[model samples]
Target: MACGRFKELMMASLDGEISAEDRAQLESHLAECADCRRELDELSELSELVGEIELPRPSQEDMMKYWPSVYAKIERGAGWGLLVIGVVVWVAYGVFLFITDPTTGSMTKFLIALPVVGALMLLVSVIRERVNTSKTERYKEVER
Candidate 1:
């Protein structure tokens, strides 16, 4: 058997989960390959050490609170999204009025457009800064 195949069988053997035929092949490979034998021994020792570890369990109350906390976060995010959409629509309407009003002079229209354009530019800059900051944040890696 190839070294890779033997290594896979070695893991199965350590877990006592290999078929008789695979076990026989693995044993044969182990007898001839010193490197495979050493690796198998190291893996067996690591598995034994891991088996002795005891992980902490979460409390019942914490488990119960998890879903509601998640839901609240989702609700807040949705509320903010709706607020932004409403503000954008209101600004767009103001721009439309400034452009189409017959009595509004060109200078007056330009003055109104300046604030709208400046507000949009500021909004874009803030959003881009937030996106770049999030990209650098390492908290996402912990969730995985």
Candidate 2:
């Protein structure tokens, strides 16, 4: 068997979860591979040391606060979303006024529209770039 396969078996053996057939195969591999044997020894010792350690438990009060903390974060996000929507609606109304107001000359209207159009185009470009970047990063993560 290859070293990789034997290493898997070694891990199972350390956990005392290997079958008789796998144990026999692993033992034979360990006899021939001193490096694997050394690794197995180290893993065994580490597992034993870790098993002897104690972990702290969370307090009941802390556990009770967890849900409220999570809800507060979600509430904050929703509040920000509504704020952004309100600002966008207000800006759009102002832009509409600039476009439709009879008092504004054609040249003045064109100048106002120019900045709004440029800003919208820049926003769209930034959103597209971010989306493409996120997709590429997700693909790389999946490949790994």
Candidate 3:
């Protein structure tokens, strides 16, 4: 009954997915509503125009060259860089907080900080190595 529901039916009609009942309902609405009729016409024209468009498919060489160099390196570098920085800042802050807390014993703080610091250092080292490797391997393809 609502125009919005009728509009939905219009899309279904365009896609040839409307049932006979829905088609009759939509036609009844379209006959009485000038605005709905206009909208349906516009949607039909748009569908036709879009259907006529065809994008050329790139060759294998072009597809291979598209990524790995420009987008892949940039995306990986940025993501890794953010991860590293965030880990460092947050871990350092957590350590600083634990160290300064008066209620916690110095020994307890040391015990907790030791493993956290070790893990953080190992993580940062691995990430740095990975970033370096990625930089070097940017232009090369994986050998199968």
Candidate 4:
């Protein structure tokens, strides 16, 4: 294996997930290449440091800190922002589609196409909002 592949194997090896054959190849390359050997050493040190560090969680006060701002953003009608974003995205997509698709398709066909495309975009925006809400809930749960 080349030095690049050797580094990849070395990472997998450090994770205790590399096959024996791949491990042997990595070892052989490290023996022959000084640069790879140094890289492997640095990566191992980084892995050790990461393993020794502890992740800190939010305090109750810190968790409550953003509540006012978040609520204010919502109470101020943030839904309009979502609507605006949806319309912008739909218009951009429609323009691209119209430019690419020929004009010979009937006026009624084109008119129907616009709403269907807009509805699909609105559906996408709704799904995105739901996912974002779920993620926020998960984070709040973790904080508590």
Candidate 5:
């Protein structure tokens, strides 16, 4: 077997999931292959260390402490998404104004307003949705 296949078999062997026949084959290979033996030992040591560590639950306060940063990051992403969409729309509008009515400066001004108004509307919607979601999550947390 290739080194990759052997390593997979070694992991299965350690997990006691490999059949007896496959276990025999892997053991025989491990005996001749120093690299496989080293990897198996490394895996065994890692499993031992993992087994020794304890997992502790976070307090409610600790969990809530992270909420602001998470919400801020989400809002920031939404803001950027809105910005990108608005810019694309603005560029398209500018192009339309240029091609369809280059002589009219008012058309350009109107085109500029389209993205600003649309972006403002989208920003409000995003903020509203975020507020609703945050409220629902807070309710669920309180219930728990």
Candidate 6:
């Protein structure tokens, strides 16, 4: 059996949340897997260290103050989503109209569309690269 499978069991056991059957199973696995036993010990130590610290609870007034800020963040995200959808739809409609115009020659439309397509491809590539880099770039905090 993979050591990964016992990880959750180890946590449950540490928390005293495991059923008797699972606790027995975990103990049996721990007896055979030295690595898992070491992991569980480390987790036990860390959990104890964390358990020693206490965070202050927010007062009702503090929580009331937070509601508007949390709501604003959610509202802003929805607003941006709607704006992007509207812009993309409008641009696509404009492009379709321009491409289908009887006055515009096929060659001209093709020439005009080439740059737009290239620009979109470049934009998408940049966004993908940024996303990939952001996952590992721990120093770039977004606070402004």
Root-mean-square deviation of candidate 4? 15.7
RMSD of each: 4.4, 7.9, 13.3, 15.7, 13.5, 7.3
Expressed as tens digits, the lDDT of each residue in 53-137 for candidate 4 is: 9999889887887898688888777788888899999999977786677764768667878898899999999999998998777
- Model 1 residue pairs with clashes: none
| Ten-residue stretch with the least lDDT total in model 3 | 135-144
Candidate 3: the clashing residue pairs are none
Instruction: Please give each candidate's TM-score.
Output: 0.77, 0.66, 0.45, 0.41, 0.41, 0.57
Lowest lDDT sum, 10 consecutive residues, model 6, at 135-144
Residue 130 error for model 6, in Å?
A: 0.9
* Candidate 6: tens digits of C-alpha lDDT, residues 1-144: 688868999999989899999999999999999999999999999999999999999899988989898999999999999999999999989988997799999899989989989999999999999999999987889676
Supply the global lDDT for candidate 3.
Answer: 0.90
Q: Whole-model lDDT, candidate 2?
A: 0.92
On residues 1-144, what C-alpha lDDT tens digit does candidate 1 reach at each position? 469878788889999999999988888888999999999989999999999999999999999999999999999999999999999999889878768999989998888779978998999999999999899987867865
lDDT of each: 0.91, 0.92, 0.90, 0.84, 0.86, 0.93
| Candidate 2 error regions (>4 Å) | 107-144
Candidate achieving higher TM-score, 4 or 5: 5
Show how many residue pairs clash in every candidate, following the order shown. 0, 0, 0, 0, 0, 0
Candidate 3 lDDT over 1-144, as tens digits, reads 479888789999999999999999999999999999998899999999999999998899988898766898999999999999999999789877877889999898889879987998999999999999988995668676
The candidate scoring highest on lDDT is 6
Ranking by TM-score: 1, 2, 6, 3, 5, 4
Name the Cα RMSD for model 3: 13.3
Give lDDT tens digits, candidate 5, residues 36-62.
899899998998899889999898998
